[model samples]
Target: MNKYSYKDLPSRRERLFIALRLPAHIQHSLRLSAELVQGKLDFRKWTDHRDYHITLQFLGDTLVSDIGQLRKTLRSAGAGFQPFELRVSGWGTFGLEEAPKVLWRGIEGELGQLNLLQKRIVEATSSLGYKAELRPYSPHITIAKKFLGQVPGNEDKGIFGVLPEQDLSDNSWLIQDFVLYVTQPGQTPMYEVVDAFSFS
Candidate 1:
């Protein structure tokens, strides 16, 4: 999706979501990884390092008045959980093979805990009128979008041909908190954290 100015956001309703903010070290590592293949690839937009996160739930175009209640609900929901380890995994794409719409880095480690936290957040927010996504939970940090580069082998070989073989086991970090963020377009870091919910 193209950048939308603050005025251009849907009906001026804040685009909000719940997510786990990656640590600086993890962000730096992912940034370096993206830099390694950026020149070789042809993607229109590479995600800003500050924007790197694992989305728990997307509450799109939300009412400004609802934010306080959302924060309260999130804090209560998050209090039951504890910190869990997670790491940046492999690379992949979303959309079609030849011309994918999104280029992303996958996630690994403590996936069951992550899913449980996500499920709790969804349930907590349901009474506030936010519906859970129909799609199954698949945690990933998006790196780029609008693929225009060519594959090495056959087009059917997909995005893996250009993927770097990097050992990211050391990229693991303890996710201690989740954040509520608002999307602000026409900015270097489009997403801004409004509040954070720390795990007990």
Candidate 2:
């Protein structure tokens, strides 16, 4: 007889997702850019540097028992793609201009490959009953959330004009792998990597 048993259920469902982990150098670059506006903008929360990532798909409330099958499917799906290059390009936001919900950094380069890989993952996970979102996929890295600063006007051209452009012209990396991440709601550096799947 073993001390641990599968008969006992896990305490809770995990909030899960698949995403590309950013390289440290790029994270540093994004950090510096955000720091430049930290005093100028008054967002309620800024993303921790360590928690930065570009999400491919969010699997909300995942069952503990489903992880094994998800991992297997992810690995097999991931094996079909080749490594591709990407770079941080610009800035954007989601929600109202006066009070946006998320402030994010944009991505560019090799986007076709990125879209294909995302589509493949969606298809791979669909067999297990994961439904894709109805909205078109728009990839971005969240830098901050819930804008609290005074609203910008036509002359200011919105918050985009306030951000200082970092020298990311030569800053790009090959995305060789993606990871399964679990969200820790109240923790600093909220996301924890559960597994990583490499491309072919």
- Number of the predicted model whose TM-score against the real structure is largest: 2
Candidate 2: stretches off by over 4 Å: 1-11, 151-157
The true-versus-predicted C-alpha distance at residue 6 of model 1, in Å, is: 17
lDDT of 1 by residue, 115-185 (tens): 99999999999989999999898899999999987634434544677678865647899988899988989
Worst 10 residues of 2 by lDDT: 1-10
Q: What is the lDDT of candidate 1?
A: 0.85
TM-scores across all candidates? 0.88, 0.90
- Please report the TM-score between candidate 2 and the true structure: 0.90
Q: Estimate, for each residue in 41-60, the C-alpha lDDT of model 2 and write its tens digit.
A: 77999999999999999889
In model 1, the clashing pairs are none
